[model samples]
Target: MTDSHDASSGAFDPASATIAVVTYNRSGLLTRLLTSISEMDPKPGHVVIVDNASSDDTGEVVESFRDRIGTTIVYRRLETNTGGSGGFSEGVRVAYELGSEWIWLMDDDVEVIGDGLAKMGRWAPRFRSIQGRRYDFDGSEFYWQYRIAERMGIPIPFAPAGFDESGYKPMNSGCFEGMFIHRDIVRQIGLPDPRFFIYWDDQLYGWLASRKTQSVIVDEFVLRRTREIKQWDMGIRHMNASSNAYRYYIMRNRAIMKKYYRALGVYQPVLFGLGTSLTFGKELIRLLFVERTVRGTSNLWRGLRDGRAISRDASFRTMAPLTESVD
Candidate 1:
């Protein structure tokens, strides 16, 4: 898991790659992430840091690393906080505009091991996008359910067993941390959606990308997350223990889920509709017995109503690509 690599087995141009990291007010964690990235072997050709109008010392941290890091670090600060979706959109647009052959992306808190990028760079040309394994803060493997539910086209939380480490598994989903994608895929699917504002954006984009080409989740590369893991019933872990606002997005994006199913076939929507009803009942029970929040019931009703209405509306617009408005 160090700098050791056997590129003779599969060599790729490391210089043709660019990295896009989106950050908010997490300057302290960003320092560690950037440091690890700076130390990556055959470093990315360019490193783009999209700061979403952070109020902290993120700018100063970037400046300090500018001279210290071994790569060309480009820091772009937005005037407002546009969330992860917006930040990644603008960052990727910039990377694409800069003419990079491959674009690697991550959040502010991930630490990239040198060998991960080296391995991903070697396989950059093979797939549309490649995802590396992520380790939790406790050094345990994270994102246990890497498999996207074949019927629903959503990630289901289940760990796979007995996979060959040397081979790749077909993936219809993606995580920003340690995700490596070719520029051509960007041309086909466009940049990641900013209007998603946060949750489900990556999955939607991953779905779109996979529709046009092949993407894979492989263990050849790796990334480690530094966060507290939250677990739920039935071996379920909320890798992202989201907030009320995030919950809103989670519910609202069901429209996106509906849209995805509707595109597949006539029966998919019917199946998904039935499945959603069951899920809604389970959620209501969870809120009643487990959560019991003061306004949880009202909020749940509002979210479900709005989400379904959003999906049913005729004017619902898919998130437009930031690259389309690139200046």
Candidate 2:
């Protein structure tokens, strides 16, 4: 996938963009992210922080930023923990309602290290959706190689050597961390489904955006991870040791994906089934051999069972489109 559009026509204005950050109990990390946002050279006009009913001082952290961030900060605390998916869904909706032309979405774990917003804006005239690269906590480039297996309806890893002269790779998938998206695309595809609860939501949302307009990840280092996660280095790629909860959602979300693919008239049961089985096997292998946690298998199978039920439910087949009026 390649995009030949010229991006020199105009630049994106930071003032027109709204930064949306989703947080849970990570108040310290939230502070780090907010500090970086406060230091952005051309600060965004609005910042929306969605607190997923954190038990910590996450709300006070956002309140502290009110006087320091130099932007219109909107803080929303959900009554329940809806996980990353719900936090981002609400964040995007709030940002869109605020009349922001572009929305920058991320978690509390990453800090903007450079003019990532400015860099993303450079490609706004050409691409409706864009993703920027990030550095690991140790300062190495984080692994973000991804491509959508259209027939299988899932994102799979790909080599990172195919960047265009403009320093971007056209992608059918996205990561919520530092994703710069336009409001027009949101109107077309709707908010990220909250039911996903965590995994694969961004990939499906990105694929949906790509269907509307070209989506690309620019070769720009804009974020640095603040948290250190345990992972096994597999030479070619690194695999992070995921939690049991993540293991569950990772499998269960495959069912939610089928619903979206079917709505879009591209669901192939045989191929999707094959893909799901392969995914289950890969995760099982990773858990047993790589992560050395056989106990997580229960979560995996349970997720698969529940996911099968979700696939059978008629209500899960459709996504609600966002209102066109951003009023």
Candidate 3:
């Protein structure tokens, strides 16, 4: 689908709109993402790539695109791996500082269907309506988060069938990979809490933002990518379950989230903590007794206990770096 706008009138140019992408060691994936951005319509005013201390040649790959892409490509490399929350927080800060009026935050692995920026540009005026695209990993099953929402009968605001045009209503926070946030909203709500480190950071940001502003989903634009699932348990071994890193962050940040929610008079955090404990406990039993990883179970038990602690720091060095090639 194509959108037309008169160049002389500057109708489609939403001043200061930028695309912010966060990457960690996935040089190949970053290259493909840059190519995708190069092909986007109504070209973004700027493109910022936050490289989280990759040991790979990610810097060279980004440098190769200096000429072809229309928007200014600003590459900022961090000194260490700070995970998604920190990377995204820095990316948004950079984009906003670079005068971006609207920021499109995306993961390195995501692929735009076609003219994604132009679609966003044409739709940018409706900044109050934050939109995200449907994501399908492996081009088969939808992401587990979406499936879980469907199972829970939670009304997905951006289903293909369309939703009530009642402006913005509160809904569960979706993944950050395919989401676009208005600059004004981010300015008000601030960046994702860095203490989160990983899981549920997007949820906290979305839920907090929704209280003051309306966020919606754009059903038309779809972002597709191949997700690598490393099986540590049995079902699907995505990043969250494969490494001890996942358990640590899940426990620590969950406690933090519970604290924040309780402070805000939201009672759902207790249920959330219970659900996480039960789910991880089952995984521990399977990995320990069935898979014979007694050490893994011990680590998980510690994680669950520490997760409930209000003052515990979850950061730790694991066996391997919590990253994989995007290809």
Candidate 4:
């Protein structure tokens, strides 16, 4: 990695960006990600790892890298696992407070390769855009845009067209893994919604950010990671094929976003709600009968009825209690 110096002060200059990685009970995977980040062509100025109350030796893994890595590494161990929303909320808040010009929000499981960060830094001069990795489950390479097309019930295209040597395209949605965001844009729009405990949290931030600035998908940046598998030990299969959490967020957040769109007089909420409900409802039914996970289905119903609410006294430490097992 190329190290630059501050001309006037004769001190090693910190990069303009900071990377915030949120992890829970994935110590091994988190270590790999940290190592990969440390080897980036242009190293980040700061790497903040938020351990979401992991019972394993996650703290030990981070400490191991304290001496080797050049960038400042700040490890904060939460008392509990506050889901993705809370973890991401706290991570981004800290990045902004530290005066980061840009924040790269990432999940622990994802790994970035090649000159991804350096390429992104080169493109930083272009408008403030939210950029994400082109990823697929396991080893398969798939366009992240396929999910958006599927959600909209549109035919999937073979590949993105009109690409130059630099891979760049207009994107409506993005995965949280390796998403680069400008600090100024986040300051104006604020943080991710903490109420969304699991799903759709990143989309909420992306959608809101799009209103004020542009959002893009950088094909060159690849966040290679496996698609989540429904394991028996994972307290809730938030991303499982049988869980209703996906449907619930799609319904409730669609409702919430529709209201915001309507207030801005941009689009009708009825159409958006109808589309989200129909798609998610089909998934919910499959989970109810085929998967037979009763708790997952029940949570869906509750989410739809309750809507999204921010509790006055909510905190990560409180939501995710320090327990031996999530069960």
Candidate 5:
């Protein structure tokens, strides 16, 4: 749990990896995250904390760890709150420019478990992009389904009763939390699109990575959620009750998502439309029954209106690759 990894140990030196975290005003949560990183076995050599123009004491919180964490702490504060998408976009770019061979992306709300980096690094030889599992606040495994319904553009929760003998499953979608990616993939795919201010940006970024290499979610447990969210317990799984801002973005981002699907030659308007409608109905039910409030419905409707405009807009585009050519 110290900054004592030997460079000659292997290709995945842990020093070659950089941890990029996007944080807002969660100063307390950020502190916990940094503490965990400081304690990680074969800890990353660099940590980039992107502050989304937090009006709170986030800057001071980061400053406190300048020399204490035993790793290079690069703190970059944005001029405005660009949400997770922008924060991560900036963080990953900074890490890449620093010449990091691998970038580990996550939010401030989670803490890395013991030797998480070491476990993730073990697969670097075989996979360029990999993901590790997480434990919820109550000690339950976080839901990280493997596949994506490409045609419908939704995550599919299908997997074997247990992890395969190989201890990982192929994944088309990516979670910003615990997504460990190699620099080659980043150069090929560019950065996470800042256009998606919040929701679904990671999915597209992950899907893009999978297009280039064999992206998979390993069975290794790497993170733990520090906060407990209010969720509606369905018989099968629990649905987290989201904020109005999240509700709005979730509805609005469908248009941006469609642009990517369209570019990939898999845009099925009828199926996508049907899926969106079902999502709308499901959210309405969640807002009414779970949250017991009708306030966020306005955001959902407004999101639909704005989403339509985005879909119709000829100017909106997907993230362009940084490299000259990509497979």
Candidate 6:
């Protein structure tokens, strides 16, 4: 699907763009993601891969594709796993250091399905932040994103729908996969908060990006969602029910997000905290009746309690070397 926006003063040059792919222990999946990049119609000029201290052979997998992606590959492995938030933060930082006017951020599990990056490259110059569309495992549009609460920093569910593939619709927030953000926006708002550890990191960053400049979720498919699709209804689901760690982080991060929204100068603490508590209740019910996991239940309870304290003294760290010398 080819969508076009009016050309701005500066036309796009592939050489000015850097693609950041963050991966964990999934070597095979990372290979497919990099392979897809190698096959893009107009490939990125530079690619940066950040490994999240995986026990698997992630380094060898990256080395195997070093010469074939048709770009300069700068691979860096973190000393430990800092979740998706840290990986993307480091990846974007390295891309900026290596000279990138535009940074395209995504995870390694997805595969580029079309000439969408080339299309984004053509349109990105006109806007500060650009988000491409994504499809699920069933080739259905991944519809859980695009609607973010402006005041509360929470993700709200809308009626499932599709978008017209011809316009760049305005958005309050978006996900990391297929996100085309400008260097200036990063300089202005700062990098994705690493303190988030995982959940709410991208949404908070996207919300900040929207505040500073023109950001939109374009109606164009770029990445095909490779992760398992959840059976969710109105955002009511088990929420990684088997994984107590995910429940803990997402629950704990909700309080962190509340503080972030407050700092953003658009927050109503009482209303937002109430709404967040209600959302937490849904996950609790799912954790109990749906998953029947005793451990998840305890994690959920502690998360709710600990999250309050977390909000009381929340802090966000920006990436160092905030401004790149490359223009």
- Candidate 3 C-alpha lDDT tens digits along 180-212: 766556665666666677866776666655655
* Clashing residue pairs in candidate 1 (N, C-alpha, C atoms within 3 angstroms): none
Candidate lDDT values, in order: 0.72, 0.85, 0.62, 0.63, 0.86, 0.75
Q: Compare the candidates by TM-score and give the number of the best one.
A: 2
Q: Which runs in model 2 stand beyond 4 Å of their true positions?
A: 1-9
lDDT string, candidate 4, 226-301, tens digits: 4455422222222235445565665455544444444446554455555656655656655655576555656566
Query: Top model by lDDT, which number?
Result: 5
Better of 1 and 4 by TM-score: 1
Give the per-residue lDDT of model 1 (tens digit) for 20-67: 999999998999998887787768889999999999999999999987
Model 1 sits at a Cα RMSD from the real structure of 5.2
How would you encode candidate 2's per-residue C-alpha lDDT over 1-327 as one tens digit per residue?
233344223666788899999999999999999999889887898999999999999988889989999888999999999999999999999999998989999999999875777877777887878898899989988988557788686657655745678798888888998889888788878888899999989988888888877888888888999999888888777877788898899899998999888887898889999888888887887787667978888998999999989988986545666786533
Selected candidate, larger TM-score, 3 vs 5: 5
Residue 106 in candidate 5 has what lDDT?
A: 95
The TM-score measured for candidate 5 stands at 0.93
Better of 1 and 2 by lDDT: 2
lDDT for position 42 in model 6: 80
- Model 5, range 1-327, lDDT digits (tens) per residue? 011123213567889999999999999999999999888888898999999999999999899988888899999999999999999999889988888889999999999997999999898877888999999999998886667777777777444436868998888889998899988788878989998999989988998888888888998999999988999877567778888998899889989999998987889999888768877887898898789998889998989899999999998778887763322
Candidate 1 C-alpha error for residue 21, in Å? 0.8
Sort the predicted structures by lDDT, highest score first.
Answer: 5, 2, 6, 1, 4, 3
lDDT, candidate 3, residue 281?
A: 62
